[model samples]
Target: MTTPAVDADSQLLIHRCVDCRRWIHPETERCPECAGELKAEPVSGDATVFTFTVNHHAFHPAVPVPYVIAIVELAEQPDLRLVSNIVGCAPEEVTIGMPVRVLMEQRGDTLVPVFARA
Candidate 1:
């Protein structure tokens, strides 16, 4: 018998501080609050664009010009937010409170979290 494959949605795990009820991003060594050991937990993929900026200037040659990067507030916790990009739409279209969902991008051996319009 073989174990079933886990979905891409399952791979976007984040840690939440039990004592302070704060969510911590991946690669964090210590909890920003309560100074407790953070544990991995599942999160809802739903979020709303909290704020964003349209960058038309590229410092790197590989990156395209005019892209929108945003900080989104998770539906589960309004205070818990993540930095993601708004894709599949024009940069001018991104606005605060725009609904978005998580998408994964291949970064070497890791799947980095990104977001697209919902």
Candidate 2:
């Protein structure tokens, strides 16, 4: 299948090592060993729910309670994961190792990547 296009302004979901050309994430100043400049760029934003937890209490009244939060592993870099909220499904429906994809969340002008079941 063809991959979707991404714009330049998006944060690098993972770090691509300048030396070894390997991908890493959560933003370090540079490659852990190489010390090369780290550049944040667009990623396909596809991932899988490696693991998750469900919360039944409301932290914010405006926000809904009984939500499932998870650490999703990006498809391109298995080790590159991000904490995201699982939506479009009930909290109890979440499961380990479930397939998910990216959904852009608007915060001011920024579009943060969130995940939902595929």
Candidate 3:
């Protein structure tokens, strides 16, 4: 089993069950429905803002205040959602059901998935 692949344009890491064809997040070793093997794969960056919040309080020095934190539904699956920041635009411009695209950002040792207006 190889490690997951990400960091490409319009790519987000997801695990797909080989047997059931179900997409899983917070990854599990096997498919809960079929007990099948899982494969790490990249999904198209297309998504929609399901919900969001604008943080006005600074929590970290490097992170600026008034950032948009959102729950976005991936285009691959109905319930396939992830927590990500809305970027490449202002926080006030974000809205529910707004289309967004994935963009990877380097934070420390990890590549974080962020979204921008599509």
> Candidate 1 clashing pairs?
none
Poorest stretch of ten by lDDT in candidate 1: 1-10
* Candidate 1 stretches greater than 4 Å from native: 1-10, 19-21, 26-33
Residue-level lDDT of model 1, residues 15-105, one tens digit each, is 7777776777643667876787777677777899999999898978877889888888878775778777788899888889999988777
Q: How accurate locally is residue 59 in candidate 1, as Cα lDDT from 0 to 100? A: 78
Candidate 1 Cα lDDT to native: 0.75
* Most accurate candidate by lDDT: 3
Q: Each model's TM-score? A: 0.77, 0.80, 0.88
lDDT tens string, model 3, 1-118?
2223474553677899988999987678798889999997889889999999999999999998889999999999999888889999988899999999988888887777788999
Which is the better candidate, 1 or 2, if ranked by TM-score? 2
Better of 2 and 3 by TM-score: 3
**lDDT rank, highest first?**
3, 1, 2
lDDT of all predictions: 0.75, 0.72, 0.85
Clash counts for all predictions? 0, 2, 0
